[model samples]
Target: MRVLVLTKPFGALPPGELAEQLAQAGADGADLLVRDGQTVTPDTSWRIAETAKALRGNGLELRQVSTDLISADSESERVIGHCAEAGVSQVRVGFYRYDAELDYAAGLDRARRGLASLAELAARHGVRLVLALHHGTLHPSAAHASLLLDGREDVLVHPDPGNQAKEGGEHWRLTLDVLGGLDRVGCVGVKNAVWEPDGAPGSWNCRWQPLADGGVVPWATILPGLQELGYTGPFSLHVHYPADDPLAAVRRDLGYLRGLRSGPFQSEPFQSEPFRSEPGTAPPAR
Candidate 1:
């Protein structure tokens, strides 16, 4: 599977430098989350285009342009147009506002309409739209997000395992069940979050730690399950850890994920009808 690292984690570096750093960290590509300083909107499309181009020049393709601003048809169209100009293949839509409140069902309705509109535009432009299951939103869980898809073949889901862990292992497992039967899941976000130490109450510190750090979500289990579910997509690493050397942490995690193996029982059998001989007939006359 391909691995795409988030470009925001290297926000301190210039776009060119960030691309190089991501390459060194073993990312096959990068997910561009465009944030314009104090605001989150599609207004920075030009900057996003420049960044996408830089990454492409450095041999790292922009797998998806993730944004929290595609809740309306106009916004979605604008973003898609910009992505097309930048030569991006997909767009990841986040369906929530910044204050962390569910933007009413009316907003979700608008988002559904927007997604459909965006999907059509994307197809016309040769791009795809993927909805990511973000934490603390209307579609916070995989099941909830699946309900939104409503059998639309064009849309895809980007599952973030670490966010599911925050919701609880039970929720995470439920998410897997919801997504287990799908055929269009395009990508997975591999992020690690560690529970705070003893003194910290009701708080969790999130960071991009190595797969072995025990702080990030358990990838060994999740990876095999994902493979079993036929989601052979990129494992994008999102590093939110605060450290002096984030690249080192990403490298270690990449190594750990690369070393993971699918065990004997990790995969499930493919479902199909049993083969049968001709009804009421003897063996074939050879």
Candidate 2:
């Protein structure tokens, strides 16, 4: 699988500087998550064009533009145009909160509409939309995401293994089961969180840790499983620990990932597929 780093880790840096640092960090590319006034918004042609130029100048390609900005239908179109201009082929859209107490059917309908809108925008820009499953939301689990995307061929699912820790170990397997049959899963986010033991804390504090640190999610099991499941998409690295150098943390995580396959624990290939797709299946037409 190819390795990618998200640009948000270096949010303090200017876009151009961040792009340069990512390339220097051995990243194949980066996923750019955009936000405005505390809310994530869709892309705009101007923003995408400028960002693309910045990334290209740094010798890095814009692999995906994450839709973190909340915008109206009219604004989404403009954002899609920018994505196309910026050369982004994939887009990740956030799902509604699954943890909320709302009418299940109504929530599903709302989600379906949002997906439809985002999918149309992505299509217009020749990009694929991946529905990212996040915690404290309506579709936190892979099963829930799968169900949410059922019958929608245009939308993809991104299962965050680290976040699934909130549901415990059993749910990890359940996540794989739910996402197994999807035909358009374009990427995976690898991260682990350390949960404080039992009731000894004021709050259930969690911290992002490198892959080998024995964080809640089992990377050894999940990473290979992802490979076996035909997930040849980008393995995006994320380091969200506070009070730590984000880039250094990400580099350590990357090192750990590389070691897993190189050390004595060397095992079979992560995925059995000879390539990302079948011989006859062409990549989605732009």
Candidate 3:
């Protein structure tokens, strides 16, 4: 598995600095975030290629991107086109939240239409869009996300076990089963969240923590299952937690992840990726 750091909290760092910090933490690459304040936002999308070059200079790859790309409009196309230019393969699409004013079916349809349109645009640009399971969105769980993904192989899903530990906890095996049996899963989200009681009566909330911290998600078990199922993809470790030294925390969690990854498939050669090559890039040497 390619261990990647989800570059959210370190968005304040420029691409070169972020890539160097992640490389120092022993991360394989960046799950590059494309947001308003980040290095590679919609307004600064032109930096994608240069950012990718900086990562490669540090022996890292820009394999995936996280973005708020929900429509097939010019803005979405613009970001994706630059991603293709930079050789990034996967783009995390935006969330579709549930609302009391909106019907669930209608909401689901809206999500699918947006995803389908986005997938078409991504395909045109040689990129694949992925959706992540969050705690409160329509994709709170892998099974629910599968409902949106049914009959659609053009898009993929990434299951965040930490988010599920907060609300939609299920067996890891069950999650892989629900997410189209691993074939349709593009990657996994690496983070941990634990519940803490509020001062008020019957009030509790979940907060983020590093993987080695006090969280209930058993990556020890899940990583093995993923390898057994022949799922080889990025584990996008999140660094959005409030930490005094987030890079140190990342180093610790990355060590934990590397230790858990010593399962059956760890030593095997990387399998050929089915994802089409980016435009203007040469194919991988066979």
Candidate 4:
């Protein structure tokens, strides 16, 4: 799998400078952030092709994008269309919140409707709408995304094991089992986190950690697990942590992950549904 760094943190650098930095960091490409005023916003989406060309000149592919797109509105369509024109196949949309005021059923309905609309837009544009397994939202696992999208092929799930390690953590084995096969996985979130004490008794907080030592994310195992499942997509490294020296940190992460590519962990493909019983006997795919 190739390594792509999320360019959200290094917005301070201009696009050319950013591409240079990523090339220095040994990144295969960048997951460009698209929003207002930074680089490729909806209003300035006409630059998609040009920007991709510039990044390509720097030896980095700009085929994947990260955006704050929760709805499939006209403006979103314009941006996505521009991405399609630029040959960008994957666009990571934003999260759907599970607000406290809304019931679970209501929240699911809202998220599913929005995703369905976005899926239609994706099909029209010939670009895949990518959804990350983000925590504290309607999605926190691969199965959650598949269920929400109803096994749609036009959309793909970006599985973030570190985010899942938070409130909605799950085993990697089960995540791939019901993930609608490997084709549903557009990319994987490459990062790790650790929960630490919050000073108050029985209280703790989750913080982003490097992918090196002293982290809970089992990359050593998940790398091979993904290979076992025949997944050869990009490993988008979301450096969701503060670093004194950002470039050095990114370089370190790239090197460490490259070392982990050889680790072996055998995984068995699922034979069938793990649950088979009456309606009341088995849990629903809510």
Candidate 5:
């Protein structure tokens, strides 16, 4: 399992500086999130390639890219082509949100159609398209993600447990059961946060914390399950905590995640069968 730094959490820095930061954090790769005020964006193919080269030169891989969803066939092909050129195996497409004025069922259908088109274009470039399960989106739940990503090897799901915690706060054990059962979870995103008891009537607030500090991610439990399932995807860490030193926070989280992955149960023998949804089955501790 390769650990990656999700670039979005670091705000925006030049590609060279970002590469240096990733190296210092001991990350094996980077999840390119081209955002505003960042060194790179989807607009220029050359910048993407240059950034990828810089990371590679520093002995890091560009595992995935997060960018806006392209509905136009030509644009989809173009974006994916650039990603392939930059040695990115996968590219993340934007989400389909539920609009108040739009019918729910109609919105889902629209998303399905749009994703299908994007997947086709990605396949042509020999790249996989990643769709993350984010809050307020049409496919926020694992069940919904399954519907959107079913039967398409060219497309995969990026599961963000922290984001899920915000929207539904479902049990990590149950989420593992649902998502691990599917073969499409190509990457996992990590962040930690807990809900605070706000004084407002019937309302709770979010308090972002360092990984393994206060959030309900259940890394100790989830890591072993992923290992038992023979997962080899990248684990991208999202730095969402408020810190006087964000870089220090990122380094600390990276160390914590690496330790958790190589914990006692990691040496256990894995089952060859697909992940079972059986309750109370602790991930193999062999």
Candidate 6:
């Protein structure tokens, strides 16, 4: 897996400056942010080309572009077209927030229809649309995410473990088990967090940590699992916390990931049980 900077942690900057910043952070690829207050937006399609050129000029590649929730089919098509034109491979689409007051079934139906239309457009443009596991959304776990995109290959899941650690967190082991078999998983978002006990007796507060420091995402386990599943996708580093020096923080986290990738972890055998009996060990007709 290769490292890709998400670009949101560096605030809004020109494409050239953004590329330079990522390069300084030891990143060779960028997952450009296409959101409000960023270099590109839904209305600004030309910026995609401009950003791609700047990244290439700086010896960097455009790994992916993240966009907000798609409420319209036309907008989704336009975004996919622009991304494909810019030579970007994947586009991370936003999610539909779950509201208890509204009709859940009707809302899901509408979401499915909109995504189906968007998926068709994405396929026509030869671009993959990513739906990440986010909190308070219709698709929060790998299993649920798989259900939403059902039979679409163009629309894939971008699993974010830290986001799953929010309010209703799922077991990471189960996440790996389900996502490993799914062909629709294109990328994985690297994020981690720890919940601190606070407020009431049973209450807790979340604190986002740098990649390897967090207690939430067991990188030691998940990294090997991903490798075992033959996942050769970009691991976009998402620093969701405030830092005195963002570049330094990212550099440290990047080093951690590199160590894991290049270390003996990948070569070690994966065992699911606590005790391992010797191979071919049989208690003589017991």
Best candidate according to lDDT: 3
- Give residue 143's error in model 2 in angstroms: 1.5
Give candidate 2's error at residue 173 in angstroms: 5.4
Q: Looking at model 3, report the run of 10 residues with the lowest lDDT sum.
A: 263-272
> For residues 1-286, what per-residue lDDT tens digits would candidate 6 score against the true structure?
6789887777768888887878888887888888777778778866899899998888889989988846446667677888999999998887777888999888777778777877777778988788889888888888777677666666778888878988667765567677655465667888788888887999898888888574776776677667866878888888878887878888888888777765555333345445555888754452
Relative to the true structure, how large is the alpha-carbon lDDT of every model? 0.69, 0.68, 0.83, 0.82, 0.77, 0.79
Give the TM-scores of the predictions, in the order they appear: 0.76, 0.80, 0.88, 0.88, 0.85, 0.86
TM-score of 6: 0.86
List candidate 1 segments past 4 Å from native: 37-41, 73-75, 97-110, 170-177, 180-182, 196-210, 228-230, 261-286
For residues 113-202, write the lDDT of model 2, one tens digit per residue.
777777777786788887776776666777777677767778777777776665553344466666775355677777788877457757
Selected candidate, larger lDDT, 2 vs 5? 5
Colliding pairs, model 5: none
Using alpha carbons, what is the TM-score of model 4?
0.88
lDDT of 5 by residue, 17-128 (tens): 8888888888998888865656676566457788888898899989988877745466566667888888788898987886879888787778888988888778777888
Ranking of models by TM-score: 3, 4, 6, 5, 2, 1
After the best TM-score superposition of candidate 5, give how far the Cα of residue 167 lies from its true spot, in angstroms: 1.9
Candidate 6: segments with Cα more than 4 A from true spot: 171-173, 179-182, 264-286
- Give the clashing pairs for model 4: none
Q: What does candidate 1 score in Cα RMSD to the true structure?
A: 11.5
Q: Candidate 5: lDDT over CA atoms?
A: 0.77
- Tens-place lDDT per residue, model 4, 231-262, is 88999987778887778889998888988887
Q: Return whichever of 4 and 6 wins on lDDT.
A: 4
Please list the residue runs of candidate 4 whose C-alpha ends up more than 4 Å from where it truly belongs after superposition. Answer: 264-286
**Higher-ranked by TM-score: 4 or 5:** 4
